[model samples]
Target: MSKKTVFKTASLTFLLTLIFSGIAFGQNWQTDFQKSLQTAKAEDKPIILVFSGSDWCAPCMKLENEIWSSDEFKNYSAGHFVLYKADFPRKKKNQPDTEQVKANKELAEKYNQKGFFPLVVVLDENGKVLGETGYKKLSPDEYIKHLETFVN
Candidate 1:
């Protein structure tokens, strides 16, 4: 192969690697509440804790597909919030470990006592409740604007 061709291939490979890695890392969500809290404090950002039943809840799936997966929401949240998910799946295959289940239950007890699926609770670094929302029929940009009202 020509030297120029080899160089082009190498550059393409590097670019593709970076692009895929960025996509993988951009939607960072933590399962551990304490770890997420520590990260929120360190980053001096608020926490957006999500409670959902991934396998069974239709609204939870809709919220994730329509809002969380959107580029607008991802970009807006990437810098402003520490994301945490406490997923309670009904399927046996999707069940988390005992410790994680217990931790998620504890988090639900504190932040989601009524057991609302797709519950989103925003909290400051000190864990004070700033705002709470659930599945809403809004576009990603509109939803982000709504969240900004609570955060700012």
Candidate 2:
């Protein structure tokens, strides 16, 4: 093989690896709030706790589809925040572990007593509440801009 062809193949392999790894990493959301808090403090990043009803809530599904799953949000969040999900799914297959369910319920008592379906709570590294938001009819960039106001 020629030098240029070998170099091109290597570069293509590296790019494909990065793209696939990014996609896998972007879907990672912590189930443990304490672990997320520790990571947030260590990384000097904020915590974004999403209280979602993944199986039943339309708004939660919309939030996931429209904002959280977007590449823009994933990229920004990967650098800037410790992501956590306290999902309260109605379906049995979608239910989390028992300990996770207990922890999520405890969190709900403190942050979401009224039980909002798609509540998003932003907190500082020390777990101080920075802001709360939910299901806005904005695109990913617009939603990120709105979050930036609270986080910054």
Candidate 3:
């Protein structure tokens, strides 16, 4: 194969691998609050609602990388919690739909009225607030333990 063709093929293969692997390993973050509530109730799990400014907040990005995207948290939370993300992306291209923006605003009013970025709220299956936290420099296991304190 020509060098150009080889490069293209390699790039395509890499992209595909990333996409499929992320699907297999990523944490599932529900976008709809009502749907998450139903799932939480059905699964008998607490709801972990996160409010983040994805494009603008440093702490938010740190938490996402260090905790939410960690293999340890992903494996543990898969069975224990219903995850939801309320993202406010300042970048125009990253903004969610209007309805989603509205819903996120409502959630913020109810749970994060202080407008704290990277806020993590633990709620009962019925959506009552159990506890809230923020970015902490801890290992995934320790973070999981901290979150469990809110639930149990």
The local distance difference test score of each candidate is 0.90, 0.90, 0.94
Which pairs of residues collide in candidate 3?
Answer: none
Candidate 2 on 39-140: residue-level lDDT in tens? Answer: 999999888889999989999999999999998888888888889989999999988889999999999998899999899999998889999999999999
Q: In order, how many clashes per candidate?
A: 0, 0, 0
TM-score (all chains, Cα) for each model: 0.87, 0.87, 0.84
For residues 46-149, what per-residue lDDT tens digits would candidate 1 score against the true structure? 89999999999999999999999998787778888899889999999999999999999999889999999999999988888999999999999998888778
RMSD of each: 2.2, 2.7, 5.9
After TM-score superposition, the amount by which residue 110's alpha carbon in candidate 1 deviates from its true location, in angstroms, is: 0.8
lDDT value for candidate 2? 0.90
Ranking by TM-score: 1, 2, 3
